[model samples]
Target: MSDDQSPEPQIFETLQPADLASRVADQVLRAIGDGRLRPGEKVADARLARELGTSRAPVREGLRLLESQGLIVSHPRRGFFVHAYDADELKEVYDLRECLELHAAEAAVARMTKADCARLEAQVQKLYDLADEGQTQEQVVQDFAFHRMLCELGGNSRILRLFDQIAAELRAGIALVGQLYDDPEEIARSHDPLIKALRARDPARLRAELHEHLQDAQIHVVQLFRTGAFDLTNLDKLSDDQRNRLLR
Candidate 1:
């Protein structure tokens, strides 16, 4: 461990332009996912380039990619900013999610096999474990993964692609209010009914369960908006109990 002792060589590999852009996009997305970059925050290309150890070109390319994904929006002269979360907009997004998921649920129930059910069950367990571990971001990801797997089980490429289109917004919505749930374990267990319906191969029951689940989420998000709990400035002023109850 002498000062002059040779250090382990770092592994370095060159990334193609597209790969670099994708990598930058992923880092920015991860920042958003973890709440480091909140809704409506400006994403300056030069600043992000400095932080990411690249140039403005790749950062601009990444911002363009994120813009296409509905995670960020560009203005005429204001550059790019994270997409703001609006209750009304979220309601519309949830409406679309419901339509897509209900259709997928029916189709999936008809075709789900033992192996598919097992994979879903494992995802549910991961959700529970992540909740207990207080890994809120990962929990949101696992929750969506469970539903995305359901859509995949339907064996419809187009429907899966459609889901992917809204995936970022969906994740953002969850990350925004994920800590507000009264009981994380209860939230994790909510998927049980859907899984049970899938196991029984009952499309009608599965559709009903899925609809109820999404409706509950919609209600919660709307309630949070109405209560003004997403105001980051006010959040710090709230009491511990209030904060936990509002954002958990």
Candidate 2:
């Protein structure tokens, strides 16, 4: 076609109200989880509205929802700040993750269809591949993906929602602990039995394996605590170095 006869470019339309709200909230939550928005970082509604290209009304509504979910806190005059990163709070987050994730594992064993097992197997294989490749970042991502898939297979929205909320807080501590260890392989080994139990569809074995997984998670966090690395300020700062190392 001649230049003058070229087709016009397509233009995307606006997001649905529900989609817009969810997208805004997800962006903000991801920022907080990734340390881009550190604990105590002020969350200004006007700034959020501007950044998201939406009105302050929806931003305020999003903030209110996040606050109620315990992800953000609004001070009388200081506006909203990221919360739930204190040492004790991290402990609580991990504990809750353990409870829900263990149950999810059990449920998954009971409810796993062939297709669900296939997906779980695929995620498990990815974890193994990432481990073999020696890509620590990809290994961590796949590791979490395996667990997330298991939760999905559990067929329980209530449990999945609870796991989703706690995963970020749990990840903060895990990322913090990364600096003090060099044993991603050792960590990756934990997934084998969990996958095996799922393949067998044995809830008892799945529950046991999950308990062991969470125990190890707890131990890893405790090690970070002992190293004085899990402190909120230390975690936030060390994360900069961690990101740089991963990039290299």
- Residue pairs of candidate 2 with colliding backbone atoms: none
Worst 10 residues of 1 by lDDT: 239-248
Error of 2 at 138 (Å): 1.3
1-248: candidate 1 lDDT, tens digit per residue:
89999975422223345577888887777666545567899888767776666778888998899998788999988899999867888778878888998998788877878898899999999989988997665566567678888888888889888887676566435544565576777768999998888888888888888999999988787667756665554333334433222221
Itemize residue pairs with steric clashes in candidate 1.
179-247
lDDT of 2 at 16: 48
Best by lDDT: 1
Q: What TM-score, over all chains together, does every model reach?
A: 0.70, 0.76
RMSD of each: 8.0, 8.5
RMSD versus native structure for model 1: 8.0
TM-score of candidate 1 on Cα atoms, chains taken together: 0.70
Off by over 4 Å in 1: 1-24, 49-58, 125-141, 176-181, 231-248
Give the distance in Å from residue 103's predicted Cα in candidate 1 to where it truly belongs: 2.0
- Local distance difference test scores for all models: 0.74, 0.69
